[model samples]
Target: MAERSEEVKLLGMWASPFSRRVEIALTLKGVPYEFSEQDIANKSPLLLQSNPVHKKIPVLLHSGKPISESLVILEYIDDTWQNNPILPQDPYDRATARFWGRFVDEQIYVTAMKVVGKVGEEKDAAVEATRDLLKLLEKELVGKKFLGGERLGFVDIVATLVAFWLMRTEEVVGVKVVPVEMFPEIHRWVKNLLDVDVIKKCIPPEDEHLNYIRARMDRLKLKSV
Candidate 1:
């Protein structure tokens, strides 16, 4: 009910990279917020009401109004808080950033869901598909420190899944999709991205992600059997 611009409340899950995006954005911009961790399995009333359509986590409640979806929330944060700009100053560059950000979220992250907890041929195919996508991203990262070049921005935020989540998931599933030697640029970009204090703080501990993915992989293995 508070109307203060800084009264940002994020309803998120600790293991979700999407939730991490909002947290990192807020932290990078120096905007303080109260985080309410949600249990997705049980589904909280607040999360349902805030995002009734999808019932998803990472909902941003700003001054009583809720904004759903991680990418949209990132844009809103950048627009509302002008100090730490996430998008580019030039219109064309901003459009380019948005394009790759959306590509990473919709294409890369969505495809990754199929690879995790999967087995046999399906898992192999998924990994190959996901790798193809990552190769394109690696080309984009060539000759750049981050997606936006020199600093982190929209594309970098969306690609955070690869920087943090992918490695942990690979360990849990006992697979190697994004091999550092193969995707050297992405590997380097990931290290550079995580070096930032905000990103380092917001990224869930590797063990936490490992446990979560291990549980999911176990369930998938049982189902396959």
Candidate 2:
């Protein structure tokens, strides 16, 4: 096995769920990389230069070549490090994994963003839409341990990240979209995800995240008022 180059670096935000996805992938693959924390509000020069298009964190720099976008970076990581592969080997399984991953990116991500940023009827609609999506996810996870089955695969990582953010957004909006009783499967999945050693270490402290969301909600309320 070829040793991964030491020059790989990850530019990421501390509290970003997107960045957490990349971090988990790297850890699961046992790929060593330097982590540079970025303040998205301040917009560090390196982050801006590395990701000129999106100016986002979770940028992967492999041997000086930067790759932006969390999903794109996950593909790059899987391709670069074949060991502890995140995607399935079979063609059909890989495709299925990709489909669920895209679903999280489109439906879950969009609804969670709306719930956190908007208010009034718009926010209510977004919350209800998110609840419906979570119900769908609960049904999908009925008998499966993870989105990609027993092992935590690519889709599981993407979905977990979205779920993490949605849970936080619920705190911010003073609403509960993914109530444990209503979505037992999702609740089980959340426990399974956090039980992983790497994920357990990577997730932000609960109180810290709650405080951050509360402050954000306060700011949003003030702006609206």
> What tens-digit string does per-residue lDDT give for candidate 2 at 2-117?
34557789999777888989988988988788999998779999999999998988899987889998988888889989887899999998888788888888887877767765
Model 2 per-residue lDDT at 148 = 75
lDDT of each: 0.88, 0.82
Task: For candidate 1, list the clashing residue pairs, or say none.
Answer: none
Best by lDDT: 1
- TM-score of every prediction relative to native: 0.94, 0.92
Error of 2 at 4 (Å): 2.8
Q: Write the per-residue lDDT of candidate 1 for residues 1-225, one digit (tens) a residue.
A: 124556889999998999999998988888879999999889999999999999998899998899999999999999888887999999999989889988988899889889866779999999999999999999998999999889888889888988888867888777889998889998899889768998899999887778887887788778768
Q: Which pairs of residues collide in candidate 2?
A: none
Off by over 4 Å in 1: 1-5, 223-225
Note each model's CA RMSD in angstroms: 2.0, 1.8
lDDT of 1 at 161: 87
